[model samples]
Target: MSVPSGLPQDTPVAGGEQRVLRFSIAATAVVAALGIVFGLMSGSYAIVFDGIYSLADGATSLVALLVVNLIAGYNASGSQNRRLAEKFTMGFWHLEPMVLGATGLLLSGAAVYAFINAIGSFLTGGRPLQFGQAIVYAIATVLISLGMAWYGRRANRHLRSELVAMDIRGWLMSAAITAALLVAFIVGLAIQGTSLEWMSPYVDPAVLALVCLVIFPIPLGVVRRALEEILLVTPTALKQHVDAVAQAVVERHGFLSHRAYVAKVGRGRQIELYFIAPAGWPARTLEEWDALRDEIGEAIGDDSPDRWLTIAFTTDREWAE
Candidate 1:
């Protein structure tokens, strides 16, 4: 495994990332509760959707936290725990992409459903809302969401965690949604005592529809990335880097040829390199070969638990192939 410079290799010491995620969970939970409460009080379906959205995000965050804990436990104790080794022979990297994909799908489904409801409401001439209460809720949620977003972004600069990146983006999305709601509610209130009073009833459904249109496709990118990991698709840039290193090793050592295979699964990069030694090459001690392997490892770089690197020297070209 080749870990990146200054990055923890998904070990227990990476607990700071978990703490950030927990903070996000707590913040999202509070916002969800507030959304549901103020949504009902204000009779705004848009606000209700916002609440449900936060609630769904919170649930997914809990799942993410659990996965993080499990992965940390595996990395910290797998060497000593026979059960864990047996249960996760390939490590827990696969779980990350799976959880991410499921969360994304769940979010997109909810948004689609909300979009349909919003459309139905619009068709029925929309619903009335207490713009004042809605505005208050939106302002509070916007502040909370922005705070969490900032915190997550700052924490991730050191952690460089995919989970944290997703968390930060979720918070930013929530903040944007709430900010939009605040503007709409304010506009609704502005028109309450004017010639546009008849337009008041349409505010809730109109905002809901707009929010849906904006957020419905937001999770698709997450799901796409997850699918790539799940499929063990080769990352182009990583493959190119690995290939270049393998080629260098082959030319430097006078090996007959070489082959390399690379794939990225979640946070893990799996690299396998095989070098075919010429049949008449001078023999070397096992220790010398090990030293060479270490040198090659250093050259490849990015050593980490999440990096699964296998390098082998073979006398037969068939083995390398």
Candidate 2:
């Protein structure tokens, strides 16, 4: 006998998460435009790179927003789109990891490309930059990026959304990059008329290379996590919890043995428990079995829409296995 809990129809989308992402996208567009225009005016490849990064980030964020909407809409009760539901019966949880992985890869690739350009410029004795224009751009970009990061973080305190969290990290990374550029520009300006004037041309490339080095490895963590989810890796903590619950149930009911399986995909938890009843044990009614499944579910806790739980009982070991 098997008892399956009611599967969630709608994965609720936090209103604040959508608002945060929309605001982030808007802010990214403005910052990206500013970065490109200022980079060209100042003849700074570093600023150009910053703009390109913002553009890539914005593009990925747009994709994330769409996925969020799709996940929220697809399994909703009374949804009119039967074709959509039929095509994606498992819901859109899988898309979350894909978006996260893509975002990490895109950002990392941009950093690598910028690093290469910075190195080439450095080797060629670097290029001249209008320090005044670069300075102004960096200061403004830093302020805006910091404000957005703070806002995203604050919103996520309640939202706890991965998309919003990733966007927050992007804003913080941008702020750090621009802040570094600001400092480098100041130094470059200060040394313009001094004995160190020869170093002015190299300043922009040097700072760009340094910033790239710092940021290139930052997204690897996100990529790793996404990969784990995509592969449906069994989460250790969840697996352990499921085992403990199954063990307690078996001991309490004097069952022969039990088997538990658990895997996490994105924010969704999938758990299955099988209990092996001894041979010649008295059979319980379906209602009694369902009540036992309910007890097991409550013991496992985390009764959320994202959880998919299945419990089974069988007299034959083969069936439990």
Candidate 3:
């Protein structure tokens, strides 16, 4: 896959992901405020939980935005200040996974707390709510959640950002939970004049419990992925791709053997290729060797600032080993 400018498709651009996060921050702020106020007024724990969820998400989004700004300012090729360069000697790639992991952990913690509260409410014969007011809040929130979810997904088509992707998933989950709450509130309202009125008290806590249960597992994937990056695990697909390119270069250059090491951390790819030349092979000039390295780099196909490629040639097998 390739971008419009014939660049590789996975290349991260400057504005798109940040723009999406900014929009999410604004939308989440509005929702969080509304949820807190209406939840307090209507005495619905589910709405309050939703509000807190959005608040936590907003905080994480802010952190992510800060990291994004730092990364954008530290250009690999452009002029940079000595202090900033020294501070980020290893690049800001490590921060990406760290932020992602923190976001996931925070979300999971909130969900667990909410779940416990829901269980307490259920065991205590449930909590009564102003169904009419709750329904109104749910409808408005559902609409906003759906709108933001759609917007995030559309932006990700171009941005292809992991942060944006996670944000989109959050929006979708919010939409589904709020939509379910809307239906349950409607049912509770209808039962006010019937024999099933007793069941009305259980509706709020029941819905909240189910919502927490469903959303609890969702962030586990994000945590797992973040851990992999933090551990510097080599991605299987990327390793295979690098190995293929190294093999081709070795065969073409008539080298005795080659060794390749690759690892991915967030958006950064680290690759090292070492080739052992045959004993008594014809000597090549430094320029020629550099040209060969360039050729191999081009063949590897990911030419971006975040890519760290190192190629070495030596007649000593120990070096390649």
Candidate closest to the true structure, highest lDDT:
2
What's the ranking of the predictions by lDDT, best on top?
Answer: 2, 1, 3
Q: Show where candidate 3 strays beyond 4 Å.
A: 1-12, 76-81
lDDT (Cα, tens digit) per residue for candidate 1, span 46-92: 88889999999999999998878776666454456448757766777
RMSD of each: 2.6, 2.0, 4.0
Error of 2 at 28 (Å): 1.0
lDDT for position 26 in model 3: 96
Ranking by TM-score: 1, 2, 3
Q: How close is candidate 2 to the true structure, as a TM-score?
A: 0.94
Q: Candidate 3, residues 16-85: lDDT per residue as tens digits?
A: 7788899999999999998999899999999999999999999998999878777766654445534776
Models 1 onward score TM values of 0.94, 0.94, 0.92
Off by over 4 Å in 1: 1-13, 77-81
Alpha-carbon shift of residue 53 in model 1 (angstroms) = 0.7
Q: Each model's C-alpha lDDT?
A: 0.85, 0.87, 0.85
| Model 2 stretches with alpha carbons more than 4 Å out | 1-13, 77-79
